[model samples]
Target chain A: MRLFISFILCVISIAKVQADSFVVDKVYHPYVLPNEQEFEWRLFSRQTDEGNKLAQHIAYGFALSERVMFEAYILGERNENDSDDYGLKSYEAEVRWMLTEQGELWADWGALFELEKQHDSNDWEATAALLFEKEIGKTSLTMNFFMVYEWGDNSRESMKNEFRLQYRYRFLPQLQPAIELYTGHNYLGIGPAFMGIQRFDRQKQLKWEMGFIVGFNGNNKDNALRVAIEYEF
Target chain B: MFKWKVNITSCLLLFSCAVFAQRPEFVLEIKDHLFYPAEIHIPKNKKVKLVIYNYDATPEEFDSFDLNREKVIFPHRKSIIFIGPLPEGRYSFFGEYHPNTAKGVVIVDDTTTVNQPLEESSHVD
Candidate 1:
């Protein structure tokens, strides 16, 4: 309850700021492991509403400013009798800053810093990426090539980097489906994938996404599926 | 016979004007999270008028890397851009905010993509 009240107060305060002062021009990026279709604050709600607490994965989020969005998800030992998973899984938070409104030569974009912890690990690993995107008509395309770093007693200082390219279409202002391709060297292992999302009210929403992660060389391929609802006070 | 001759002359004039009036136009339509008629190709050095129409209540933008253009397209409204005598290459565009939902392409080259090529395609999405 306290968390909810704080979020509402934060929103009310941020509302006083002008849209031009920050780079948060749009919202959502439609794909999973990628981005959902970005809609503006005015269109945050449309097809569906973010569901109840049980329906949501063990997580919490705060939209501090238009340009900054933050989230944390947990995954510990699953207790069949318990309603919520209290285990601390990997931690991740992102901030999408608008660098510019200028043309392609100086493309304005969003970048994120994400951290993850292994199931039984103590130290946290991180992924740093830069997303340069543009909007054409009702379509938005983004090119992201980020590096994943490992941190541990036995881990290297800087581990590896990967590249991703994605394209999304907003068929309806609210219903957006997306396609994505990714690889280690931008082509190490290529895969085809998609995701869908909807938010019916201001900060309240629900989103669903699926991913077909294809691997390269001797690596195995796998499919990831996720469904969740979120509510903001 | 006189009536038939007059009708034929008028029809011919209309046809000629229609063919001559054909102007190249490009539109990126967002439907079901994908741009209908995803790919468009136009010849280089042609006077072209491009308009993007977003029917959804959410606003979208037409962005391209090859052509060096970016314009915000509001919901239920139209965004317009003009290109003249340009180079040849593949120029891709998409909605900046919704990269996951909207996308399309524009291929500018010496060749054209529509049949009966009428200078370029005056009708496209």
Candidate 2:
């Protein structure tokens, strides 16, 4: 228990570093339904002093079993300053493992591993993350701690760490409100998010999320808008 | 690295074996957006299998926040899910499409027998 507390403190301290960059993205939960499959699309747009940058990701995910899932994504980005040089940016593959049974532990535990390769370049990045979630009454708290390593001929060989946290209220099955926080090197953002689900016939549902995040640093006017839609069957 | 891979694979095999092992089975029928047995009793602290048969023409999603289980049961089809190894308590579930009528409760009790006789009460909305 002491070790766990120390580890959490360490992660928080790492996240307390200064802010400038915007890396606000999805906050994952620690549950995987058996034999589940999903198709998802996400959009992230950021407005900064440099210009507006937009990225979109399309992904397909499927469960291998009750405890494991795999997903692949195609990413694209367009920068306003780049003058229409927008196309495929990267390809990514990810795996998630549910490490603990729900409600059987103090907190549910999971792990995520991701590998990404840049298009038309020898730049690659890998990330390993720990996912934790706990339910308290009508609310749920979730956290992701990520360790990322970047390498390749076109990129600097470096290692980085990041964290994302979400606190959500379960008002109803269809609609939920949440507060999300993201922290990385030179990136700190907090915002309100809303997510909802619309269920169709047997094992099919559509989920949607929207969030607007603002950076904390005063030196730069940095903010981001993110939207995601998922179809699960 | 090879040793680590082997160790991980072994652990996963063991876990999967435990999960797929045969367990007590219970059946719940859905017709006209109502559960036939409004409540079920299962042994506490033991994993059990639940097979839901949907006779309605429209699909329904079986959802339970207390049990942390959710699945979609297609019309005229059956779906399976595992629940339990839980403490003694009452867990409620409802059909997402017809929350008013398609509702049921799982009663986990230490003294309850496996596959207990179904109660005659049928709840409809």
Q: Which candidate ranks first by TM-score, i.e. highest?
A: 2
Taken in order, the candidates have interface RMSDs of: 10.3, 5.1
Model 1: chain B TM-score vs. truth? 0.64
Candidate 1 chain A, which ten residues in sequence have the lowest lDDT sum?
A: A18-27
Kindly report the docking quality category of candidate 2: incorrect
List, residue by residue over A1-233, the lDDT tens digit for candidate 2.
Answer: 79966976577567656322346889998878766899999999988888989999999999998689999999999986585777899999999999986655558899999999999999999999999998765688999998888899988888888888888888766788999888887777789999888877656789999998987767898898999999998
List lDDT for all candidates, in order.
Answer: 0.49, 0.83
Question: What DockQ results do all the predictions give, each relative to the true complex?
Answer: 0.02, 0.10
Residue runs of model 2 more than 4 Å from their true location after superposition: A1-10, A16-22, A80-83, B1-37, B40-62, B65-68, B71-91, B95-102, B106-125
List TM-score (chain A only) for every prediction: 0.56, 0.93
Worst 10 residues of 2 chain A by lDDT: A13-22
Question: Each model's number of backbone clashes?
Answer: 48, 2
Q: What is the two-chain DockQ of model 2?
A: 0.10
Please provide TM-scores, in order, for all candidate models, with all chains considered together: 0.42, 0.72
